[model samples]
Target: MKIAMWSGPRNLSTAMMYAFGNRADFAAWDEPFYAAYLKRTGIDHPMRDEIIAQHDADSVSVSAQIAGPVPDGKEHWYMKHMGIHMEDTPLDWAEDCVNVHLIRHPARVIASYAAKRENPSFWDIGFQQQLEIFERFPGPVIDSADIRRDPEGMLRKLCIAIGLEFDPAMLSWQAGPRDFDGVWAAHWYGSVHKSTGFAGAEGALPELQDEAAKLVAQAMPFYAKLAESKLA
Candidate 1:
């Protein structure tokens, strides 16, 4: 099965990628559209010029690389993508794959992102935009909180959606470094690699400033809308 995993920034998308990539039968590709999006929109992404300088904003080439055939006859392939990527022009590559949308509480997500000195960008906004995106897509959408709360159950549901039987093997994966992960792994997910199970608490990251908190509060309606949609 070809599966595309979509999520917002700092929403455990990378760690989830690690879990799926751990499977010997799965091949994973990380954040391939970002360079292209940055270039095409001419938006100021955090690593803007750096990424464009390296990849030259060639999304077609990047899309090709992302959709390239897999090796070892892996039955499943996964690609990690950010939700903000869905725009006026959708990727033709995602047309036939099973899509899994991962969403998190905006308060926690934005707070976590701000703690890391990360900019929220337009992608961080909750509600109408995000809700519309989720509702338009026909696929399984998993709440990040639920995934963390019940990894096993959620994984089974995910497997079922893609026409695969639940493999107890996916419940837990051995943690380690592997190729196919983005270079940002070392910086963003260092603590995740060392964890054996879910890291219960949202660690002691810096608190969001009042201004940021207010902004997140304003986005709560959208978050609530998403929570409702996922439950529905």
Candidate 2:
């Protein structure tokens, strides 16, 4: 089985990768198109130069690779992807995978994202692009907030929904970077790397102001549309 999890940054993406990676039968991959996106867009992300230099910047090759095989001869492959990273690259690869959209409330997303990179544009957070991906390859949707509220229940439901046996290993994992982390892990994966399991239920949604508030407002509609189908 190949699972393609479509998501935006500052969501629970990394932790979810770790969860699936911890499962003995699954091999997890961090964003496959990150380097390609950075190369194509020339966005000045935190470690753009290093990310492009270290990871493959060839979108065609990247696309073919993800479509090709589940590496290490694992029973399943779990790929974490950022919707904003996709462009003209073909999405035909998604047809073979159980595609899932993982979403977070924009207010929470905006607050977390702003702390790392200031003054983000609407596109940076990925709500609109994710909706586009969902519209095309419609599948199950999961909310980070709901997962935080009940990791075990939600994970069990997700596994069943996909016709995969539930693995208790998904509920916890060793804390630290995996050998497969993207080159940009240093800048982005700190908190998740330190976590042994899902953090407790999140607190109240953060209050945003000015640019952050405006960006959240712009993202809310898309987030809501996607959230409408999230696993309850």
Candidate 3:
């Protein structure tokens, strides 16, 4: 089976990727369309040149790669994708794979993202794009907070939802990067690369600035709708 776990920035996506990568039966992919997104949007992200040079920049080719075979003939493929990356890309191909939505509270996402990119907009945070994908191809939605609070419990529910047996290996992984990491890992994966397992729940949410507060307000409704369908 091919499973696509869709998430926005600052979510537990990398940790989830590590979980699936630990499974012997699964071949994991990290943001396969990132280069394509950067190329299409000409966004001046860190490592922009290298990322475009290292991976296929065409959305069509990247989509084909995702729909293609699991590497090394693995029994299953687990791909970690950013919802915003699919903004200009087609979605029909995704129908062939099991799509999983990974969400985080907008406040948390905005805070974390703002630390890296100043003055982030709704598009950068990806809540709207995530909602669009969920509407187009509905699937299981798992909150990052839920997984962090109870990794095994939530992951078991997720596995059952996706028709896969929950493996204990999903609980932790060796700290550091893996082959499946995208070329932009240097820019975005610092904390994740140091993590051996999901971090515990954070303390009180940080206060958002006026602009960010407005963005969060805009995202909350979409988040609430998806959260309603999240795994218990």
Each candidate: RMSD: 3.2, 0.7, 1.0
Q: Report the lDDT of model 2 for residue 34.
A: 93
List runs of model 2 lying over 4 Å from the truth. Answer: none
Q: Write candidate 1's Cα lDDT for 1-232 as tens digits.
A: 7787777777777778877877878888787776777777887645567766664257667667556776557878888877665565456777767776777777777776776656664455433455665666657777777777778777777777668777665555567665775555555566667765554535343456777777677776766766665622
Could you tell me how far off, in angstroms, the CA of residue 11 lies in candidate 2 after the best superposition?
A: 0.9
Error at 138, model 3, angstroms? 0.6
Q: Kindly report which residue stretches of model 1 are placed more than 4 angstroms away from their true locations once superposed.
A: 42-50, 53-56, 65-68, 122-129, 201-209
Candidate 2: worst 10 consecutive residues by lDDT?
Answer: 207-216
State which candidate, 2 or 3, has the greater TM-score: 2
Mind giving the per-residue lDDT tens digits that candidate 3 earns over 14-107? Answer: 8899999999999988888889899899988889999999988888987888777888889999989889998768877789999999999999
Residue 44 displacement (Å), model 1: 4.5
Off by over 4 Å in 3: none
Please provide TM-scores, in order, for all candidate models, with all chains considered together: 0.81, 0.98, 0.97
Q: Residue-wise lDDT of candidate 2 within 37-83, one digit each (tens)? A: 98998889998999999999998998899888789999999999999
Residue 33 in candidate 3, Cα distance off native in Å: 1.1
